[model samples]
Every structure is written in structure tokens, then in C-alpha cells.
Target chain A: MIKQERAVRTREALIRAAAESFDQDGFTVASLTRISSRAGVSSGALHFHFASKAALADAVEEAAVVVLRALTHDAGRPGSSRLQHLVDATHRLAEALRDDVVLRAGFELSGEAARVPRTDLRVSWRDRVERQARRCEENGELREDVTVGRVVSAVVAATVGFEVLGVRNRAWLAPGTIAEFWRLLLPTLASDAVVARIRPEGTLRSAG
Target chain B: MIKQERAVRTREALIRAAAESFDQDGFTVASLTRISSRAGVSSGALHFHFASKAALADAVEEAAVVVLRALTHDAGRPGSSRLQHLVDATHRLAEALRDDVVLRAGFELSGEAARVPRTDLRVSWRDRVERQARRCEENGELREDVTVGRVVSAVVAATVGFEVLGVRNRAWLAPGTIAEFWRLLLPTLASDAVVARIRPEGTLRSAG
Candidate 1:
């Protein structure tokens, strides 16, 4: 049990160290030597945990996926409006991108120009969004002219854009930045009554 | 005159070859030798025009900027609505990204993690959008609830997001993609009269 616990702790430290390096310098410049040293492990030990840099990035992305799941957990709330589900998810995602290094690094790596992304965080996030937009279409939530595909395109692009800009400037990931997106987008999709009830700041029920 | 014309043509060929290489393999992986070969120029001739890879990339970006100027030149159209100016810019930008390799590669390099970007394509584009959004706020075209900063945030994020996503998928750069963005966002910021007049597909006068 102690050996397994130590193993887990070592893995956690390595992931954190890798996140910091990847976040600061990007994948091409990220140094595995620095990461292992920061994690208080030998190169051999680091390699034992992760076979290569890509493997390490995959682990960071995995840790970030866990964070993403928790960030968007409100989407599964038993009875919330599908529109609200999306609004809250964007807000929570912004919060995560702003506050969490692993998630931030995961996002950076996912969008990096160098690799075939192994983690698929952006694709999964986009898929979840498309699914919810479809639900909104089935109900009476969308505007008369709006289609699920259009909503998906706008929401995905804006959120992903925020994520991209946030790589250089954290302001892009601020709650207000996403709130502005919702404020403009919500009214275009929801009925006046529904729009009134949908909180652009995200409801207390889902604010991370 | 003949000698000077040959030099200009050789420089143009090198820049186009560099852009094609950078767009396909990214900045880090692009080979100078391959670029010169593709340009039908010897290594010495390529070096005479551009000092190094970074210099070549800068040339590509500058050429792309010239394309960008023509792409958004309609912003100067007299008596045009500022909202329409922004809309036309996005549509023309999408078309340019779809059709122009130098512009596309410039965008890729501007967002690239490998170096400090010299061109500032995204920054200049965002600045233009901010300028037009502020104009919208001042002209009573915006709804009472929307603010200039919010408009800038939503518009910049969505448009930049489209540019980034469009790098991989040309569909994101489709005219309809940007039109949908304006379609959803127009009603949120503008009154019914203004919204009805705003062309989501952009104006015929400015269509590229």
C-alpha cells in the first residue's frame, strides 16, 4: 500500500512539473530534464512513470480531462435548461482555464501546431457542446431562425478562441469575457422569458 | 530595369515557397533547402533575398499583411455602417484565409508557439475589430444592454477562434460560418431596424 501510494504521489508531482514547463515554454521548448528535476525525481524514475515527452503530455491532458469533467459537471444536472447548461459550462471552463495550470497546459498542448493530439480535449469539449445545442434545438429554446449547427459553430469557435487568446493573455479567460459572449448570444437564441432566467455570469448552481 | 524585375520575381517566388512550406510543416519543421528548391532558386540566391528562416517568415507575413489590407480595405468605405465594416472584414478575412496561402501561413506563424511573432496579424485584426466595435457603441446602433468592451470580446474571440479552427478545416473559414456569427450577434447588439439592414453575408459592395 505504501509503495502504491508513493507511486501515485510521484506521478502527481511529475504531472504538475510538466504542466508548469509546458505552460511556460510550450511543447517544443519544454525540457524533460527540468521537469524531472522539479518533480524531485531522477531521469530514470521520470521515464519509468512516462516513457517520453509525448507520454508526459498525454498524462497532463488526462489530468486536465478530469478537471474538465468536474468543470462541466453541471451539464448533467437532472433538470436544468439545456441552454443554461451550456452557459454555465463556458463560465466554468473559463474559470478553470484561468485558475488551473494543468487544464491550461492541457489546452495549450491540445492546440499546439506540432503534434497529432493524443488527448483530444478540444474535440471532446466540442462534441459535448454539439450534443447540448442539439437538445436546445429539439426544445423551444432556440430562435426561429437558429439551427443547431450554427449554434455549435459560434459557441465552439468563441470558446476555443477565448482559450487560444488566453494562452497569451489571461484576460481572455475572465468570467466577464465569457459573460459577454453569453450576453450577446443568449438573447439571440432564447425567448425573452428564458433569456431573463439564463444568467450570463452563470448561475450559483454551476459557478466553479 | 530587367535585372530589378528578375530580382522582384525571385523574391516573390521565395516568399510563396516559404509560405507553402510553413503552412504544411509548421515553422519548426519547415526546411530552408526544400523551400529554395521549390522556388526554383539555388541556396545562394535564396540567401541573397532573405538572411535566414526567420527573415523569410517575416517576408511571408508582410506579403500576407498586404493581402490583409486588401481583405479589409472596405472598412474605409464612406457612409458605411461601422457594424457593416466589421461584418465585411470578417467575411473577406474568411475568404482570404480560404484562398490565400501566404495569409493562411501568416496566421499560422502569428499564433505559432515557436517564436516571438514579428507580424502581429492577429493583434492588428483585433485592433481593427475593436475600433469598429467602439464605433458601433457610439452611434446608437448597439442595444442599450450591450457595451463596447463586450462587443469587442465576443467579436474578437469568435473571429480569432474561426481563424484558428479554420487552419485545420476550411469549413470554418466558409462565408456562411462568419455569417452565422453576425446573424446571432446582430440582434443582441442592434435594434430591429439596424439588425434588418445589416447584411450577415456582408454587403455586396464589399464582397470579395
Candidate 2:
């Protein structure tokens, strides 16, 4: 059991180091030697954890997905509309992006032309957002004039923009920015009666 | 005059070749030899035109800026509101990204950490968008409840998102996608009296 725990810790360290390398140097230029050195591990141990650079990137993407799933899992609290869930989720995502390097690196790698990874973090996130928007429509929370396609496109593009821009400027993902986006849309997006109830800044439990 | 025109042609070819290389291989892995060959020029000729890869990238960026300026310069039609000009410019920019490889590559290189160019296309674009949003406010076209900062952030981020995504999928920058975004925002974005006059699809003179 002790040996297994040690192996897990070593894997985590390698993954973290790889994430840092990929983030700073980009996937095309990141060096495995530097990653192992940053992780404080021997070449043999690094290879044991991840055979190839692509494998290491895959591990990073998977780990990021785990973090994403955790944050999005609890978004649908009881008594909250799906639209509110989505609004809160955007804020939570921006916060995670601001704080978590692994998630950010995973997203960066997915967009890169260097190597084709098995997972696409942006596509995955976009799918989740679409699902929630559809739910809002089904629940009659969406305004009649707004098509699901428009809502999905705008929300995905804007949030993806925040993620891409956040790579250079964290302020793009600030709560105020995301809140203001919802504030501009909520009036036209939500049914007239539902607009008052939806909080652009997010609900108490979900925002945190 | 004949010699000067040929020199200009050679320079243009080299810039186009470099833009294509940078777009496909990214700024880091792009090869100078490949670019010169693609331009149908000798290595000696390429060196005569550009001292280094960074210099070539700067040329490409400058060329792109010229294209961007031309598209935006005619946006403010005499009969149109500032809001309409901003709307039209987004469409024109999207069309440019879709059809103009040099413009697209300039944007890609600006965001790259591989080299630091004197000009930043994304920053330049954000500043331009901010200026248009401010103009809308000055003309009383923007709703009193809508802050200029919110418009700037959302518009810049979303357009950047479209550009980034369009690198992989042309559909992201499709007129429909951009038009839908404005559709969702225009009602809430324009002041009550000004909402009816703004064209989300862009004016005929500008959309093309």
C-alpha cells in the first residue's frame, strides 16, 4: 500500500511538471527532460509514468476533465433553474481557470496543432454548456424569441474567448466580466418573468 | 520602375509564403527554407528581403494590419450610427479571417510566445473595438443601463473566440454565427429609441 501511494504521488508530480512545461513552452517545444527535471524524478521513473509526450498530455487532459467534472457536477442544485446553473457554472469555470494551471494547460494543448490528443477540453466544455441551455429551453426558462442555436453559439464563443484570452490576461475571466455578459443577455434571454429570478453573478452555493 | 515592381512582387510572395508556413506549422516549428522554397525564391533572395524569421513575421503582421485598417475605415457610413459601424466591422473582420491567410496568420503569431513582434493584432483589435463601443456611448446609441466596458469585453472576447475557433472550423466565423450574437445583444445594448435603427446583419456596403 505504501509503495502504491508513492507511485501515485510520483505520477502526480510528473503530470504537474508536464503541465507546467506544456503551458510555458507550448506542446511543440516542451521538453521531456525539462519536465522530469522539474518533477525531481529520474528519466526511468518519468518513462514508467508516461511513455511518450503525447501520453503525458493525455494524462494532463484527463486530470483537467476530472477537475471540470467535479465543478460542473454540483451545478444543478435544487430549486435553481438550468439557466442559473449555467450562469453559475460560467463564473465557477472562470475561477477554476484563474486558479488551476492543469486545466488551463489541458485546454491550451487541445487547441494546439502540434499533436492530436484524444480529448478535446473545449469541445467537452462546450457540450456541457449546450446541454444546460437545452434544459433551460425545455423548462420554459428561455425567452421565446431566442433560439437555442443563437444562445449556444454566443455562450460558447464568449466563454471560449474568455478562456483563450485568459491565457494572457486573467482579467478576461473575472467574475465581473462574466456577470456583465449575463446581465446583457439575461434580459433578452430569459422569459420576462424568469429574468428577475436569475442571478447573473450566480447563486450563493454555485458561485462559490 | 520595372525592377522596383518585381522586387515588390517578390516581397509579397515571401510574405504570403511565410504567413502560410506560420499558420500551418505555428511560429516555432516553421522552417525558413520551406518558406523560401514555397515563395519560389532562393535562400539568398529570402535573406536579402528579411534578416530573420522574426522580421518576416513582422512583415506579415504589418500586411495584415493594412488589410484590417482598410476593412474598418469605411465602416462608419455617413447615415449609420456608431453601433451599426461596430456591427458591420465584426462581419468584415470575420470575412477577412476566413478568406485572408495573411491576416489570420498575423493574429496567430501575435498570440505566440515563440517571438515578440512590435505589433499585437489581438491587442490592436481590442483597442479598436473599445473605441467603437465608446463611440456608441458618445452618440447615445448605447442603452443607459449598458456600460461601455461590458460591451467592449464581450465583443472583443467573442470576436477573438470566433477567430481562434475559425482556425480549425470555418463555421465559427460564419455570418450566421456573428449575426446571431448581435441579435441577442442589440435589443438590450441599444438605447430604447436607437434599437430600431441598428442593423445586426450589417449594412450592405459594409457586410461584404
Candidate 3:
């Protein structure tokens, strides 16, 4: 049992190291040998865990999916307004993109043409945003005229833009930046009654 | 004069070749020799035109700037609503990003961290957008409550987002897509009087 736990820990460490290299150097230029060295593991050990660089990237992407899925799940918990849930989820996601190399690398790698990821992070994000927006529409939180497609486009584009811009300037990832975006958009998207009920900063107290 | 013209042609070919290579292979992996061969020029000729890969990237960025500045200029022409000019310019810029490899490579190269650029394309773009938004405010095209900074943020972030997304999906760069964005945003940004007068497809007749 102890040996198994150690192996799992080593695998996690290697994935983190690979993510760091991919995020800093980009997928095309980053090397497996360097990733192993950064993880303080031998090349043979890295090979044992991941047969190739693509496989290692897939593992990193999977780890990111796990983190993002949890954020989405928590934001969608029952009894909360779906629009509020989406607002909270987007804020949490911007925070993750800011603080977590694995999530950031996952997004960057998915965009790189040199490799095909097991899952496309952007597609998944669009799907999630669409799904949440549909729920908001069903809940009557949306204005009578706002379409789901337009909301998805605006949310997805702006959030993805923040990710790219934050690559150079971190201010793009600040909570206030996203809050301001929501404040500007919410009035346009929701009925006045719903808009008043929703907080751009989000109602959930937890920072996560 | 004949010799000078030949030299100019050779230099232009080399710049186009370098932009193509950088766009396809990215800056780190693209080779000067390969770029010269693609241009049908000798290695010595390429060296005469550009001292190094970074120099070539600068030339491409300068070319992109020329195109963008022209678009901005046409949009800001007097007798047109400044807001309409901003909309038309952004659409034209997106079209250039889709159709012009040199311009696209210029943006990608500017984002690369391996080398510092002579000019940052993103900074230039943001400055131009801010300047245009200020013009719109002065012309009384904007609603009283909408600050220039907010307009700048919305315009910069969404346009940058479309560029990044369009790298994978050309649909993001389509005229209809940007028109939709402006359609949604204009109603909130302009007073009812201005909104009624503006067309999301823009009022400008120029193709530039």
C-alpha cells in the first residue's frame, strides 16, 4: 500500500513538472527529459508513467479537467439560481486559470497544433457554458430577448480572452476585471428583477 | 534604379517567406535557411535584408501595423459616427487577421516570449482602440454612463479573443460574427438616438 501511494505521488509530481515546462516553454519546444529532470525523476521513471510526451500531455489535460469539473459541479449545486451559478463558476475558473499551471497548460496545449489532446478544453468549456446558460433560460433568469447562443459567445469569448491576455498582464485575471465584465453584461442579459437578484461578485462566500 | 527595384523585390519576398515560416512552424523552430529557400533567395541575400530572425519578425510586425493603421484611419474619417468607425475598423481588422498571414504572424510573434519585439502589436492595438473610443465619447456617440475605459476594455478584450479563437476556427473572424458582437454591444453603449442611427454592419462604404 505504501509503495502504491508513493508511485501515485511520483506520477502527480511528474505531471506537475510537465505542466510547468509546457506552460513556460510551449508544447512544441518542451522536452520530456527536461520535464523528468524538473520533477527530479529519472527518464526511465517518466517512461514508466507515460509512454510519450503526448501521453504526458494527455495526463496533464485530464488533471485539469478534474479540477474544472469540480468547480462546475460545486457552482451547479441545487437550490441556487443557475445564472448565479454560472457567475460564480466563471469567477472560480478565472481564479484557477490564474493560480494553477496545470489548468493553464491544459488550455495552452489544447490550442497548440503540434499535438492532439484527448479532450479539447475549449470545446468542453463552451459546452459547459452553453449548458449553464440553458439552465438559466429555463429558470427564467434571462431577459426575454437574450438568446442562449449569444450569451455563450459573449461569455466564452471574454473568458478565453482573459486567459490569453493574462499570459502577458495578470490584471486580466483579477476578480475585479471579471466582476466588471459581468456587471456590464448582466444588465443586458437578464431582466431587471433577475439582474437585481444576481451579484456580479457572486453570492457564494468561499474564495475557491 | 533597376538594381534598387530588384533589391526591394528580394527584400519583400524574404519578409513574406519569413512570415509564412513563422506562421507555420512558430518562431523557435523556423529556420532562416528554410525561409530563404522558400523565398527563392540565397542565404546571403536574406542576410542582407535581415540581420537575424528577430529582425525579420520586426519587419512583419511593421507590415501588420501599416495594415491596421490604415484600417483605423479609414474608420475614423470625418463625417462618420466615431462609434460606427470603431465597429467598421474592428471588422476590417478581423478580416485582415483571417486573410493576411504576415499580419497574423505579426500578432503571434508579438505574443511569443522568446524574443522582445521592437514594437508590441497588442499595445499598439489597445492604444488605437482607446484613442478611437475617446473620439466616440467626444462626438457624443456614447451613452452618458458608459466610460471610455469600459468601452476600451470591452473592445480590446473581445477583439483579442476573436483573434485567438480565429486561429483555430475561421468562423470567429467572419463579418457576421463581429457584426453580431457589435449588434449586442451597441444598444447598451449608445444612447437610443445614436443606437437608432447606427447599423451594426457599419455605415462605411469603403472596402478597406
Model 2 docking category: medium
Candidate 1 structure quality by residue, lDDT tens digits, B47-104: 9999999999999989988988777665455566878877888888888888889998
List model 2 lDDT by residue over B15-94, tens digit each.
99999999888888899999999999999999999999989999999999988888777445565699988998999999
DockQ winner between candidates 2 and 3: 2
Which has the higher lDDT value, candidate number 1 or candidate number 2? 2
Error of 1 at B104 (Å): 1.4
Proportion of native contacts kept per candidate = 0.64, 0.62, 0.26
Which candidate tops lDDT?
A: 2
Query: Each model's TM-score, in the order given?
Result: 0.91, 0.95, 0.93
What class would a CAPRI assessor give candidate 1's docking? Answer: medium
Ranked by DockQ, the better of candidates 1 and 3 is 1
Residue clash pairs of candidate 1:
none
Error of 3 at A100 (Å): 0.5
Error of 1 at A14 (Å): 2.5
Question: Which candidate has the highest DockQ of all?
Answer: 2
